[model samples]
Target chain A: MTDLLRTPLYGLHLELGGKMVPFTGYDMPVQFAGIMAEHQHTREKAGLFDVSHMGQVILRAESYQAVAGAFERLVPMNVLGLGEGRQRYGLFTNEQGGVLDDLMFANRGDHLFVVVNAACKEADIARMRAALEPDISVTYIEDRALLALQGPAAVDVLAAINPAAGEMKFMDVATLDLNGAQCWVSRSGYTGEDGYEISVPADQAVDLARALLAHDDVMPIGLGARDSLRLEAGLCLYGHDMDEDTLPAEAGLVWAIQKARRAGGEREGGFPGAQAVLEQIASGAARKRVGLRPEGRAPMREGVELFATSEGGEAIGKITSGGFGPTVGGPVAMGYVPVDLAKADTTVFGELRGKRMPLSVTSLPFVAANFKR
Target chain B: MKYTEEHEWLLPEGDLIVVGITAHAAEQLGDVVFVELPEVGTEVTKDEDVVVIESVKAASDILAPLDGEIVEVNEALTENPGLVNEDATGGGWFFKMKVSDAAPMDDYMDEAAYNKFIG
Candidate 1:
């Protein structure tokens, strides 16, 4: 317990009888009421989450264009095309084109703001510092805390507090007065729902959270339901679904690579591991990420070996993230397998414990996405 | 009836003892989504892990209360694992084992003692 860090909302969580567990470096709640009930509530109404543990970095330079260009050179996204108050999902890759972390990049008028996973914060910051030019200065915003208000009723609840919230589209961001405290609010979340991720000063965090919870449709959610929600939506977690050993192409994140960044293109910018990424784009990756649906009620958890039937029942893949998807009403998983066997409806086998469980390669986003965009 | 320090409850039935997680333990575990039980006829030692109970957040091992040979497992857990959350001390029995050494029963706490222990 001495080693675990606490967020600004720790006191509030304890007051609400949240079951705290060590996650990353913070003592976070795994659940509040319960996982299934909280999950269903979020799907039907709204769920409030304390995400202050995530890293917030501000990139400032002489001009916003310079910082944006410097950031674009480090990742594969089209950062320059982003308008003010717009946010886009980006990934930080290693020298081998493997993802280090997936993060959100926002063009905040004067400067570029970025938010990354808590577990990968140190490494991500070091990587950016090493890659960016000397002119670009990246500052860690340790004085801020982040909160997510998510689900279908999120707009209604937030609109009640700030009527302007109803006008914001998905992936767009704006500075709004949340309980009279100016904060950065982005219409984005990891739960595949219509939600707002608000960044406020640490001191104002508890007040904002309390104000949001006062809404009739909003309830406190914890990490337990967060994982299930993301799993059900087929979203890949940073450490589980990908790592330095996994290339972006093989991880089924080709969408993150803008078309303008393709090989032999005029707008193509030089970045580390550009040659390997281009080659992967042209020849196609050897293996690709896919969703797996196991037969029966048994779950195919991480580290489960996958066998390809066409190749003499060869072990060609491994489960990365797997669990019981409450919304899907069964067990679901995502893993990487040979490109040839990554097609939807393809038969596969997962070795669970000592028994072989029948599985099938299926399309991702097992549940429908409810983003307002 | 007796309870182990690990929060497992046992009731004598014929030559076997019915084993189930306590209500207090179930409430702490939140929702029980999956259960992995040992096969009948398998031998287990006291305090050794013999069953797995998974919630949406994590998976925990259920330790055997005493050394014995497993005689039966709860097949109901295969389809409706939430029984452990609904009635952990009653219908949610995990398995039954034929006692290998009756001496270990002395180490278990009686109902009143177990209640005081939890309190």
Candidate 2:
């Protein structure tokens, strides 16, 4: 606890009975009101998550286009095409077509504001600075904290405080004054539900969190449920599902890569690992990320080796993110398997505890995404 | 009734003994979504992982406290595992085992020792 960093809501989490644990470098709450209860509450009603540990950067250059161009060099996404106030998920790739980090960058009309994973943000910022010119301002905003309001009832609760927030659709962004604090509110979240991520001032975090928690529909959620909810949504976690060795396409994140950067497109290949990524796009990856369903009640956790049922039980892949999905009412998992075996309904076996359990390859998002289109 | 440092409880019943997790263990494990008990007739050694209790976030092993052959398992756990969280000491008892030897009971913790150990 002495060495771990504390979030603005650390004291508040302790007051709310959050079980504190060291995650990355922060003394974060792993659960509050239990994992299952908080997960169910977030799915059925609304839950607020304090995601302040993630890095927030304000990148500025000679011009807005110049800023986008500098960032596009590091990532495979079409940053230049991103519209004003519009947010798009981007991937920072390595020369071998591995993901350096997955992040959200919004075209804020003047400069590009980005949010990156907490564990890799420092290195992520350093990498960006190393590539871009010194004149470009790569400012890591440390005085701000992020909060996620998610679920079916999230829109109504947030809208009550700021009507403009409710009026926005999925993936929409607006910088509004909420309770006298200027915030960047985005109608997007990791949970497979209608939600918003608000970037608020650090000093005002507790007040804003308390105000939101005051709503009957909203409760405070912790990291345990956050993982479960995101897993149910088929979203890949940074360190677990992907790392520097995992290609974006192989991780089922090819959708984040735009066509303009692919082969026979306007921008052929310029980003790091663009050649490998483009080549993989033309010729599909050897293995692909997929969802897995256990035939029994036992959860097939991460590191469990997967095997094809045929050919004397040949090893195929391994579970990356696996756990019991509260919404799905059973154990659900995601792993990388051979391309041939990545199809839905393909039979595979998860070897755990010296026993083989039958697992079926299924399409991701075990629960339907309720994002407002 | 006696307790183990690993959080298992043993209740004497003639030659056979019932084993289950303590209330402290259940509370720490949180919501029990699934419980996998060793099959009846299976022989287990002390401190071996005989039962696997799964919460939403993680799976924990309930270690055996003594050498024994399993005689009966709590069938109700398969249908409703949450019973462990509701009543860890009573209906949530995992299995009944025929002790291979009772000498190991000397090393097991009593209620006072177990409570203090957990605290």
Q: DockQ for all models, in order? A: 0.61, 0.81
Docking class of 1: medium
lDDT for residue B30 in candidate 1, whole number 0-100: 79
Provide the lowest-lDDT 10-residue window in model 1 chain B. B52-61
- Which one is best on TM-score? 2
- Candidate 2 chain A: worst-modelled 10 consecutive residues by lDDT: A308-317
The deviation in Å at residue A169 for candidate 2 is: 1.3
Q: Give candidate 2's whole-model lDDT.
A: 0.91
Q: For residues A1-373, what per-residue lDDT tens digits would candidate 1 score against the true structure? A: 4699889999999998899989998999988989988998898999999999999998989877999888977787878778998999888876787788899999999899999999999988888887774788888889888999999999999988899998999999999998988999999999988899999988999998999999889999999889889988889899999987777788888788887777766558466667777778788999988999997677788898998753345688899999888889788899998988899999888887666778988998999999998
TM-score of each: 0.93, 0.97
**Candidate 2: which stretches are off by over 4 Å?**
A310-314
Scored against the true structure, residue A11 in model 1 reaches a CA lDDT of 95
Decoy 2 TM-score against native: 0.97
lDDT per residue as tens, model 2, A1-373: 4699998999999999999999999999999998989999999999999999999999998788999887888988888998887899888899999998899999888899999999999999999889875867899999999999999999899889989988888877889888788999888999899999999999998999999999999999999999999999999999889989998878988899888777886886899988898888878899999999999999999999998873356678899999889999999999999999999999999997878899999998899999998
